[model samples]
Target: MSLFPEDIASAARAIIADYAGKAWMIATAESCTGGLIAGALTDVPGSSAVVDRGFVTYTNEAKMDLIGVQPEVLAQYGAVSRQTALQMAAGALRRSRAHVSVAVTGIAGPGGGSDEKPVGLVHLAARCRDGRLLHREMRYGDLGRDGIRLATVKTALEMLAELG
Candidate 1:
């Protein structure tokens, strides 16, 4: 019995398998989900052909320093904002030699709920081919810390699949 959702993992495996023949590379800038997306991708055999790197920028400082999330953006929109997500993806794309990049930042928490940003609020961004960035936001609605992170990872993998 695996701890992760079997079907999502299977789908991720399929996605990577489909892209394995081509010279595709994936880079991840993660926050709420840590490195779960990268874990799922690397689970597949020979994922080195596709997974180039993963950036686990779990803190505001890390998001800024590692993935180039600017201080102004962090101050203006906060660390978990969409603007930060986009910057994180762009930074990952810039830092790594990968063809595609995905960034996730969020408050996957048991208690970090406010009127504007709630516990399950997540922001995701992807940059594909020449630094074009796309964003997604989801309020996962109090699914606990681990649950929200897992959900974010699942969605990130699916978004990566869409890149194919």
Candidate 2:
């Protein structure tokens, strides 16, 4: 059995199939979801042709070092903000050979909730080398860590498909 939910697995398969048809490759930059977004895509057979690389930037330093997320942006808007997500997507595209990229940054928590940025809040961004970009802010409200991360993965995959 697949580790991901059926819906997620199905979406991943569709993304790989569609992108592969166009001879396009994909890259992922993840934070709160860890590498689940990449994991989902790589789970599908033949994904080797479609997936280029994945960056699990769980820390501020990793974001900057691995994907080139600017330190100023992270300081100004924090890691989970739209700015960071956008930079991450752009950075993934710049850093990889992939034709498209998706990025996710968020607070998936049981204890990290604050009045302003609560648990289950996620920001996602996707970019295409053709100059297309997309962003989504999801407020999944306290669905617990695993739930929030999985939800982010699903949405990230959807964004990638949209870009493709």
Candidate 3:
């Protein structure tokens, strides 16, 4: 089924409501999951009060241009590494008026499998209100592009809850 993870939708609603009550805005910089995290948040009726915007930076150049990710970071660690994820999140928080931001980048594919960075290699990071950043990496196995993205979105939602 090409559908969203239901657990994510439930958690996202709580996160949205929490941030809305705090009057804090959030943003997303997405790659492997496109804008699914944003979509999940927007699924909640009052999400507009907490979500400011989302940036789907699916390419390295887009990540650099839209989120201010330094070229040096990409050159040193590539786009799917923790360093890049941190840069992406920080850049999103810096550029957007949102109080916080999350970033995701990875090779979510059935063809991009490799020993180092396999098909389900996802890296996630978040920049919180106090200017702190948290990052996590996961290999969701070869669940194909959609599956990997869905799993990533679910994990991202958990991270969002922690951020909330």
Candidate whose lDDT is highest = 2
TM-score for model 2? 0.98
For model 2, how does the per-residue alpha-carbon lDDT over 60-127 read when each residue is reduced to its tens digit? 99999999989999989999899999999999999999999999999999887788899998999999
Per-model TM-score on C-alpha atoms: 0.94, 0.98, 0.94
- lDDT for every model? 0.86, 0.93, 0.88
lDDT for model 2, on a 0 to 1 scale? 0.93
The numbered model that scores best in TM-score is 2
lDDT of 1 by residue, 22-113 (tens): 67788999988889888888888788888999999988999878878899999999988989999999999989988889899899888777
Give the range where candidate 2 is weakest over 10 consecutive residues by summed lDDT.
108-117
Stretches of candidate 3 above 4 Å error? Answer: 1-3
Writing each residue's lDDT as its tens digit, candidate 3 over 39-118 gives 98888888989899999999989999999989999999889999989988988888888988989999988786678898
Q: Give the Å shift of residue 64 in candidate 3.
A: 0.8
Ranking by lDDT: 2, 3, 1
Q: For candidate 3, which ten residues in a row score worst on lDDT?
A: 1-10
State which candidate, 2 or 3, has the greater TM-score. Answer: 2
